[model samples]
Target: MAETSITSPHIMQIVGYKNTGKSTLIAALTRSLTFAGRKVAVIKHDGHDHFEMDHEGTDSYSFAQAGADAVVVMSEKRTALIERQAIPLEDMIKYLSRYDWILIEGYKQAPYPKLVMVREEKDLSLMETLQDAVGIVSWLEHDKSESMKDSEGLVRHSVHEAEDIARWLVSLECHEEKRRL
Candidate 1:
């Protein structure tokens, strides 16, 4: 049998501490990007040893309990899969490369183009620990503050301003596309 595939890693990540609006920002960005005709794939970190897609007693979960290696639930509108395996981030990223943009929600330590979210004084130093940071999204009351002054050399955007962030990400994907060509 022949396998088919398509992937274009216009990859970027949104990293930050818990409750820092990473998920909110990603949801807004995904809505905006998809509305603008871009295919965006998102992978979220569960921050645990196990991740569950279906609730117990559901048909899919029952299949897994029966020792099925994979369970796929599909409807005319959408499809989801619950599988058992461990794949490295690099391999997973490559597997999902068949999209115009790949936006990651965690794995802060991974080396990739990132939009690091900063929300508190203590999180200020978190940015410095990130790799390949393209921009910082500030969730502070004021966009500029003494605490954030040390975060030099990265573009800053307000967390509440989701459209602006989405626009910036779209441009990043375009820039990467040119570089890839």
Candidate 2:
């Protein structure tokens, strides 16, 4: 099988501290992008340890015990997986290149265009830690703060302004497509 496959490739990532609405932002972005007739791929990094089998006695579980590094069990109805190994983010990105854009949840430190969700002053530094951060969506109001200012173009936006964000993201994608052409 091909390690990576794609057509037009662009990536946007959402990163933030726990419960800062990163998940909600991803959901909204997905909905808006889909509504606009764009195919989107998503990758989520889970920080937790261990995995559980939702289907305890399923064939996929048996293949996992038999030492399949990655098993993609597909049927007419659905699909499932049991895999091991640290799948590099780049590899995953390449695999999703077929989509118009890929939206990543977590992977805060990955070198990709990112939207950081922040709620407090302490979480502000994380924006710097992430690469290619284009903006921040915030729920807290910090008086006289420049947390979103940087050498790279930075946009400070309200989390509730979903339409604004969706428009901005669509514009960005349009610019990217033009550059490719």
Q: Which prediction has the highest TM-score against the true structure?
A: 1
Clashing pairs in 2: 6-97, 6-98
Q: List the residue pairs that clash in candidate 1.
A: 6-98, 7-97, 7-98, 8-97
In order, candidate lDDTs are 0.78, 0.77
Task: State the local distance difference test value for candidate 2.
Answer: 0.77
Q: Per-residue lDDT tens digits of candidate 1, residues 13-129? A: 999998999999999989987887778889887888675578887888888898999888889999887679877888888877777678899998888888888888678788767
**Which consecutive 10 residues in model 2 have the weakest lDDT in total?**
1-10
Q: Quote the RMSD, in angstroms, for model 2.
A: 4.7
Best by lDDT: 1
